[model samples]
Target chain A: MRTLILLTTLLIGACSAGPQPIRYGEDACNYCKMTIVDQQHSAEAVTLKGKVYKFDAIECLVHYVSPLDETTFSHLLVANYDNPGVLIDAKTSSYLISPNLPSPMGAFLNAFDDANRSSAVQREMSGELHNWQSLKRTITTRNQIPN
Target chain B: MSRGLSLILFFFLVSISTSVGNKLHVGQDKPYATIHSALAAATAGDQIIVHSGVYRECPVHINKSITLTGYGMPVLDAEGEKEGFIIEADSVTLEGFEIRNTGFSYIEDRAGIRVKRKHISSFRTTDYITLFFGIYLEHAKSGIVRNNALHGKPLGEANSGNSIHLWYCADIDIEGNLIRGHRDGIYFEFATECRIRQNISEGNLRYGLHFMFSNDDIYTGNTFRDNGAGVAVMFSRRIHMLNNLFHLNWGQAAYGLLLKEIYDAEIRENIFQKNTIGIFTEGSNRINYVDNDFLNNGWAVKVAGGCEKNKFHWK
Candidate 1:
């Protein structure tokens, strides 16, 4: 029983070891090269090779991952907009796009782990609520207009 | 004489008589049907002249050191495709064309013209739709990009790109271009020893000119107006900013010129007018600000903490 418990603990620790904490005002975004100033709209991604990529905004993270195969990444983490520096699973998080809530990159998209919190913000902010896939699709579609 | 001897003599004579460079033509009624075909047929030091017409095609990749000149501003429309032109060879020149519709991609830094060690001039880019970059230079050295007009859609920063973007380049010259309505009009990252002069950058979503980690650069006689922020020089050294105009850049978080983590720079003979902040400095050292006009700004100059050995003088 002790051996089984040790194995379980090891597995949990390995799984929980994901992205690192983003250093605000120092670390630059991998996509836009802007300094990561706001923690609320920030994101971090860990590749399979254990490379960490930080983003100043959720839109920057989405744009960086849009052209790649999503399965290659080990973890996609986003910071809670209300609680700074707290990361949640990006795949399971809910997002709201509202002009009232300004982001560092001006996309105005914020992430929330709880659906009820997202809905509450949506009611207050009056913008569209979306899951990860839908939000990615929306950004992709919006950027694909012919010039 | 034998037939083989006669054929050999004819070939030798032709080789001796042919010139070093040839001029190829491409248009609706020209010899070649498409620019790609003309480029394929051209050799080094040759010239390809394209007449005026609208063409819908893939990105024209130039791998040879040739001059591709267009007459009457022929339009190369990508039509939501990837890119308009990709010049990979050194000493190549692309001039006088209307390059349009380089569609945006999340994965790729799409551009109307992507060059490495080339000279680009006399072109126009129209942003009927949103796109990434207008002219993107990567790892290019001693190149020239001048006399271009780039028009971008006035999208937010999340969706838009820059008008001229340079990455890891050095000793390039950018002059006499008119750029508008992108994330940043001119963006440089890890670029060194470049010269930017006499260009007009306006209505950008971000700063008109954004510099990051670039050193030994000089910008003179440029105009940056009505952008989200006028200009930002960060993490750099030995920069010279002279005789430029920064005007009407107003926002809650904006400045006519922002200097951060910079050293050994000269900011002189510039005009800053009607901006949210005329000049904002942070963590900079050993800089000279002389003979610069600050007219009707929210704050003329805001010096943050950690700055040292900076001198400011009025005209």
Candidate 2:
């Protein structure tokens, strides 16, 4: 009976879907009409209903999710620059904003899995490193500027 | 000799001298094993031949007028570094190379081959993304790009770049190239008097061909298929499009051709099939569409607000 339970648990764990790879030439951004080609600058959000939405840039994803209610999305993910095509939890990842590191939508935000690497890049590229909360604040502040 | 005879003889002699420049070889057996070294040793009107091998280098700058040809299609792999080639001289010809893996950068415009001046041909780029143009021409006058293949892996508009991008260029000829999976297959920004012919651009994320603020350009005998936003010609005058095929470009905002703020253009003898909209026009004036075939499209032609003096003939 215990062996049967363990087998079932393993099957369930394997079946759970996590972050998916953004098909670069094939997948279009949900917000912008542009295709998602930048591996390091892309974002993905999974809704409560399990529908995944991909964004070309982190700014686009932020802009899209900012207007929604907190309960709408189940997960938000960002690509790690050190490892291309790998998604990490957006809330936990560290972001570096620099003029030298230009993002797809001119936001110049890059995500890193390691805080030390983020700080290293910050030293070289001359930018401020921020967590998700601080990065959101900066994005909101930038978006408030009138075009 | 007679004056005319002497002039003809002199011209022939000059052509012979120009064509008979010294040849430099770069191979395992040759004195120079790297293209960079061969290029450094070469002068104007010389020929540098690269043998078959994978060369890991970035930003191969060509500043002298010379012919750089490869035997057995030497691979110039950038390996996700910087750009592959940068040409800055006049009358330079580059041919037969497999240039690949230009790293993506938002601030810099990286490319498989960037021509600031002069000519290139018979090259290929495999799978680039995000502001990495396959072939780029900037401020160049009178060049030719032909018989090349450019493939991109575009996921979004902000990340993808144009396959063949031209800016502030004039009298350029682009022909016989296959471009796929880019933001735009061919993009002309402020480029004038260019001719695009016999190229196949398909499966791109944005328009197969995009022209912005360009004038007096002619595109003929090209195929554009399965693009996202389709083809767009905007803010241009005296443009001629003939004998082109636009097919299977279907999306909510897609059209076979979108003309905005264009003037005195002639679109004739083209085929538009299986597109969301065959032709979408806005703020365009004095344009002529004649003998173009439109079949199996969602809307044949949608003329939006502020369009004037346009004439369309079914047959």
lDDT of candidate 1 over B88-204, digit per residue (tens): 887777888887778766435689888865343322222222256899988788888888888886443445677899887888889898998887899987789899999999988
Clashing pairs in 1: A147-B129
Q: Could you give the DockQ of candidate 2?
A: 0.12
Q: Candidate 2: misplaced stretches above 4 Å? A: A1-147, B1-20, B118-131, B155-157
Instruction: Looking at model 1 chain A, report the run of 10 residues with the lowest lDDT sum.
Output: A138-147
Query: Candidate 1: lDDT over CA atoms?
Result: 0.82
CAPRI class of candidate 2: incorrect
Candidate 2 yields a Cα-based lDDT of: 0.81
Candidate 2 TM-score, C-alpha based: 0.67
Model 2 chain B weakest lDDT span, ten residues long: B122-131
Error of 1 at A117 (Å): 28
lDDT string, candidate 1, A1-147, tens digits: 999999999877776666788865456677655656555788999987667999988988998998999998999998897776788899999999987675555467999999999999899888999999998998766732111
- List the TM-score for candidate 1's chain B: 0.90
